[model samples]
Target: MGRSDVRPSRSSPLAWGVLGLWLLVVVLALPLAGQLGESTEDEGVDYLPASAESTEVARLTELLPGGDTTDLLLVAQRPGGLTAEDRALVERRLERIDALFDVAAGDPAAAGVVSGDGGTALHPFSLGELGEEEQGQAVGEIRELIADPPQGLTLALGGPGALGVDAEAVFESIDVTLMLATAGIVAVLLVLTYRSPLLWLLPLFAVGVAAVAAMALVNGLVSWFDLTVTTMSSSIMTVLIFGAGTDYALLLVARYREELRRLPGAGEAMAAALRGCGPALLASSGTVSLGLLCLTFADLNSSSGLGPVGAVGVLCALAVMVTLLPALLVLLGRRVFWPLVPRHGESRATGRDTFFARLGSSISRRPVTVLVGGTLLLGALALGTFRLPGPLAEQDNFTETPASVRAMELVADAFPERSGQPIAVLADADHAQEVREAALATDGVAEAEAGREGGGWREIQVFATDPPESEGEQATVDALRERLAELPEAKALVGGPTAQTMDLADTASHDQRLVIPLVLTVVLLVLAVLLRALVAPLLLLAAVVASWGAAMGLGGLVFGPVLGFEGLDAQVPLLSFVFCVALGVDYGIFLMHRMREEALNGADTRTAALDALRTTGGVIASAGVVLAATFCVLAGMPMVVMAEMGFVVAVGVLLDTFLVRTYLVTSASWLLGRRVWWPGPLGRRPAAPGQRAAVDAVPAGAGPRGDAG
Candidate 1:
C-alpha cells in the first residue's frame, strides 16, 4: 500500500483538469486575439501626448463637420520631367481616385497641392468621416490604382492615410513572425538545456497556455477598464509571456530534477521544488509587473497602455508556470528526464560538473580582482553612450525603404525649397484670413493658404522652406506655434507629420525623466522585501543599473557606426532601461535567494556564495539564452527603433546572466561574506569554518526546500 514509483495515483485527474482548463482558455482567447488588431490606433492623433496642444487640435478637428481628417499624398515623378502624356495620366488618375470614394467630397480643386518642379509633384487629397479600417482600405486601393502608371512616371503614396496602412502592415507581420520565432527559440533552447525530448515539451505547452491566458486577460482588461491596447503592446506582451514563462519553468523543473535524486514519489519531489523556488519566482514577477505599471505615469497613451498589458502578461506566466507546469511534470514522473534520470538514493552528479564550480573557485581566490575588472569593463562599455545619435527620423523607421519613404525622399530631391509634409493650423474661422497671412509671414514659411471652415474652425495649410523633419522645418514649425499662440481669439493649434514626431520625441524625454526614477524605486522596494535586507538590495540595484548603462553604451556603438544607423528612437533608452533592470534582476534573485538559504542553514560566507553559484549557474545561463533570443526577434522587424530596443535588451540580459550575476555579484558576495545579509539574523552569525558546513546544510531526511533552486 506504499506509493508506487510509477503510480497512476491522483495525478491523472489533476493533469487532465489542468490541461482542460488551459485548452478552454485558449479557445476563449482565439476570438479575442482576432479582435485585438481592431484595438490598435496608429493615426497621427493616437501618438500625441494627451496634454499637448496638438491633441486638443486633433480632438476639435474630429468634432468638426467632418468626423476626422485623413490626408493622402499622390506623387508622380519622372526623372527628367513630366511630359504631356504623364501630366494627362496624373490628372485622369487624380480624378479617378476622387470619384472612387466620397472621401474627397468631389473637390478636385482641393487636390492640386503640388511641387513647383514639373519632375515631381504631390497632391493633397483629404478625406473625412471614415473608420480606421475604411481609411486603410482606401489607401490600399489608391495605391493599387496608382500603379501601372505612364512608363516613365514613378508613383508613390505618403501622408496620414498611407503611413497608417504601412504601419499596420508592419505590425501585422511582426505579431505572427515574432510569436513563431520566439516559440522556436524556446523549444530549441529547452531541448538543449534538458537533453530530454519529453521534458522540453511540457514547459513549451505550459508557456503556450500562459500566452493564451495573457491575451484573453489583456483583452478583458481593455474591454472592462477601457484601457488602451495598441498593436505594439499586444506583440510585445506575447514575447514577454513566452520568455518569462519559460524562465519560471526552467527554475522549477531544474529544482524538481535535483529533488528526484532523493525523493521516491514524483508528487513529493515536485511539491518540494515549488516550495523552494516559489517565493523567489513570485517576487521576481512582482518586480517586473509593478515596474511595468509604473509606466502608467507616462503621458503618451501607447506607452501607458503597455503598462497594464505587459503586467498582465507576466502575471499570467507566473500562474501557468506555477500550476500547470508542475502538474504535467508530476504526471509524467521521473522518466521526464529520460536516460539522464535521477533516482532515489543515488550518488549526486559531482563526477564531472565543474564548469560553474571552477568559475566560483576562481572568483573566490581573487574576489577583489574579478569585481574590479568587471566594473571597469562595464564602465568602458558604458562610455559608448556619448556616441549615440539623436531622435530617429520617420524616413529611417522602415528597414527596407517603403514606397511612402521613397516618395518623401523623391519629393525632397526635386523640390529643394518645399516640405514634403506641411503643418496644419486649426484656427477660428473669424480670422481665417489673418491666420493665413500670419502663417505666410512666419520666418521659415515657404507658402501658406487657407483651406476649409467648419464648426467655427478653419484649416490653414503652411509649408516649410526645408524638407520635413529637417532642422529648418522644425524651426519653422516652432515659429508658427509661437506666432499662432499670440492669437488667443483665433485659438490656433498646429499639427502634422513633423509635429507628431517632435511631440513624440518630447514625450519620450519627459517619460524617461519621470518613469526611470519611479521604476527604480518600485524595483528597489521589491528587492528589499524579497531579499529582506537593506544593503543587499542597494547593491543589487546598483549592479543592474550599471549593466543597463553598459548595454546602452554598447548599443550606441553598434547603432551608429557599426550597424550604420543614423539615430536611436527617442523611446529606446527608456524602454531598454526598464526591461534590462526588471528582467535581468530575475537571474540575480535566483542566485542570491539560493545564497540566502545556504547562509540561513549556516554555511560560512565563502562556502555559501560558491555553493549558490555552483548549484544555480546552469539554470540561470539557460534562462538568459531563452530571454535574449526572444527579445532579439524584434531585431528582424522592419522598424529601426524596435531593432535597437531588441539589441540593447538582449545584450543587457547576457551581461546580467554571465558577467554581472556570474562574476561580479558572486565576487562581491564572496568578499562581503556574511555581511552581505546585513541586519539579517544570518548576517550576525559567525561561520563554522569552510567546506564541511556546505555539505551539512540539509541533513538526513529534511525536505528538498532546504537547498535547491
Candidate 2:
C-alpha cells in the first residue's frame, strides 16, 4: 500500500475550477475594501490634566455643575511671548477644531478654550463619547490645521484623540512589519531548503493565494459581526498562512523526492507523495488550527478576534498545500531538483550532517547527563521570571515617534494629576442622587464629577491621587464600590483607567488558573491520540512546560534587571504559554513521527533515534530558525510590550527546537523503544508480508535517482 506504483484518482480540472472560482470571488470582493476603509468613532473619553494649579479649583466649578469630564487637551505654544495677534489666531483655530466634533450639551463651558503658562494655550475639546475612528480623524484634522503653522507659534494636539491617532499608526506599522518579516523569513527558508529557485517559489505562490483569500474573508467577518478586527490581524494571518503553507510544502516535496526515485514517471511520483503524506499533513494542520481556535475563550476582544481568523488562514493554507502544491510539483517534475540531482550509483548519504542529530546521539548515549544539565540550565533561566516588570508606561502602547514621546512627556509634566489614575463610577439611573451622595462620602476620592442626568441613570468621574494599577488605586475602587452598594438607589459599576487595570489583573488571574489547565489537558489528550502512548505525551508535555517556564524566567530577568522594570506584563504569561505550547508540539510531532517510521522499518531503538534525528533535524531546525527570526522582528517595534513578546517567543522557539525537541524527546524515545506505543495495536510485531514488501520497496537510505551509477 505504501509503494510508489499506486496512483490516486486525479481531479485536475475540478481543482483548477475551484481555484478559478476562488479568484472570481476575490475579484468581486475588491470593491468592498473601499467601503471598509472608513474609520470608526471613539466611544469613550479620556481626560488629561491642566497645567495651572488654579485649574483644579476651576475644575471644581465644572464638577459641581454636573457635566461630562473634559476628554481633549489642545496645547498651543509660541516663542518669546503671545502677541495679541497670536492669541487671536490661536483662539480662532481652537474654536474651529472644537466645532469639528460634537460636544456634550449639558455644560457649554466644557467646550471652551483656555491658555496655559507663558505664551502656551490649552483648549479642551468635548468628544461626547465618539468612536475611535472619529477621535482619530479629529486629531488628524487638528494636526493638519497646525501643519504649516504661523510665525513664532507651534501647535501640539494632546488628549485621547492624539493618543488614538498615535496608537493607530503604531499598530499599522506592526502589521506591515510582521507581514514583511514573515515573507522574508519564508523566502530565505525556502531558498535554503530546496536550493532551487523554482522549488522555492512554489510555496510562496501557494501562500500568496491563501493569504489574499484569508484577508478578504476575515474583513468580511469583522464587518458581519461588528467586531473590531485587531491591529494584529495581519501578523496573525502572516504567521498562519506562511508557516502552515511552507510546512506542507516541505512534507510534500520531501516525500515527492523519495517517490520519484522509485516511481516510473512524474505523475506517479506526485500521486505516491500525496497518498503517503497527505493524511499526515491534514492531521497536523487540523491540530494547529484547532489549537489557535482555542484562543476564542480569551476574555480580551483582540485575542478572541484572532482565533477564528487565524484558524481560517491555517485551514486555507493547508488546502492550498495539499492541492495547489502537488499540482505545481507535478508540473515541474525532475527540474525542481535540477543542477544537482543525486548520482544514481552513489551512496545516498549527503556530507551535510546536522548539529541536532549529533546532539541527539550524544543525549541518547547519556540521557541522565543530558537531562540533568538541561534541567539546571532551564532552572537558572527560570529564575529571571521573579524579576520581570510591569508595563514601562501607559504611552508604551504608542509608537516612539518624536511627536508621541513629546506628547507623553508634556502630558506627564503639565498634568501630574492626569498622568495615570482616572476612574468612572456608574450607578442605576433611578438612584443617581443616592449614588452621587454615596460616592462623595467615599474616602480616598480626591474629587467626583457627575455625568449627564439622563433617564435617572448616573455616571461620575472619580479622580484619585493614587497611580493606576497600584494598591492604592485598587483600594479606592474597592471603597467606592462598597459605598455605592450600601445605597438603595444605586448598583455601582466602576470602570476606567484604574478600574480597567484591576479588571485586567483579575481576568488574567482567573484565566491563568482556569484556562491553562484546560488547554494543557486538551493538548495532552491530543498528543496521546497522535502518539498512541500515554507516557510519551505526559513526558513531552512536561518538557514543553519546563521550557516555557525557563523562557518566561529569562524574559523576566532581562526585562527587570537590564531594563529596570517592575514585573512582567500581566498578559505575557498567557500569551507565552499558548505560543510556546502550540509551536513546541510541532517539533515533538516531527521528531516522533520520524522515529515511529524508523522503528516500523526495523531499526533498533537507539539506531532509530539517531536515524530519526538525522533525517528530521534539518527540517526542524530550518522551521525553528524561520519562526524565531520572524518573532524576533517584533523586538524592533517601538513598544516595550512587543519587544518583550518578540524576545520571549524567539527564545522559546530556540529552546524547544534545540534543547527539548532534539535532546529530551529523542532521548526519551530511545529509552522507550517499542514501548513508546505500548498498549496500542501498533506496538505488536511487524507482519511478515509487510516486512517483505517494505524491504523490497526501498532501503532505509535511498537516493533520489534509481541506481547508484
User: What TM-score do all the candidates reach, one by one?
Assistant: 0.92, 0.81
What clash count goes with each model? Answer: 0, 22
**Candidate 2 per-residue C-alpha lDDT over 1-709 given as tens digits, one digit per residue, 9 for 90 to 100:** 1332223224455455656765676587555533433322112121111122112222332343234333556565665656777667766776666566576432222323333445555555555655555666766776787677787776676665466567666765676677787788789878988888677888888887777767766677767876455545446556767876777777677777777666656667778878776655665676666666776676654555566877788888887778777776665556667654422233444333556555654665566667778778888888877777763345454334446445445544444443233477666667766776677678777777776544444667677656455567679888887776677446566766555555555656665776678668777777777767776677778888888889898887787677544445556677677777776777777677666666666664455667778777777777777667767776566556567766787788889988988877776665555566666544555433333111112223332111111
Among these predictions, the greatest TM-score belongs to 1
Clashes of 1: 0
Off by over 4 Å in 2: 1-70, 75-122, 127-137, 144-155, 223-228, 342-347, 350-357, 391-393, 399-409, 415-421, 468-470, 560-569, 638-641, 681-709
Which residue pairs in candidate 1 collide? none
Writing each residue's lDDT as its tens digit, candidate 1 over 1-709 gives 2334444335667767886787777898878866766666665566567777767777776676644667677777887777878778778887788777766443532435455656776676677667767977888888888888867789888766677677777877887888899899899999999998688998898888888777777877878898887766787798899889999999999898888777877888888998899989998899899988988999887788889999999999999998888888877787677757777766665532479987876776566789999999999999999999877787787777777777777778878878866687899999888888889888999888776678889988789989888888888889999998888888888987677678888898899999999999998888888787866777788898999999999988888787777778877888788899999988998998998887776677667788889899999999999999999987767888779988999999999999999999988876676678777766666655433343323223322211221
The CA lDDT at 442 in model 2 is: 80
In angstroms, what RMSD does candidate 1 have relative to the true structure? Answer: 4.8
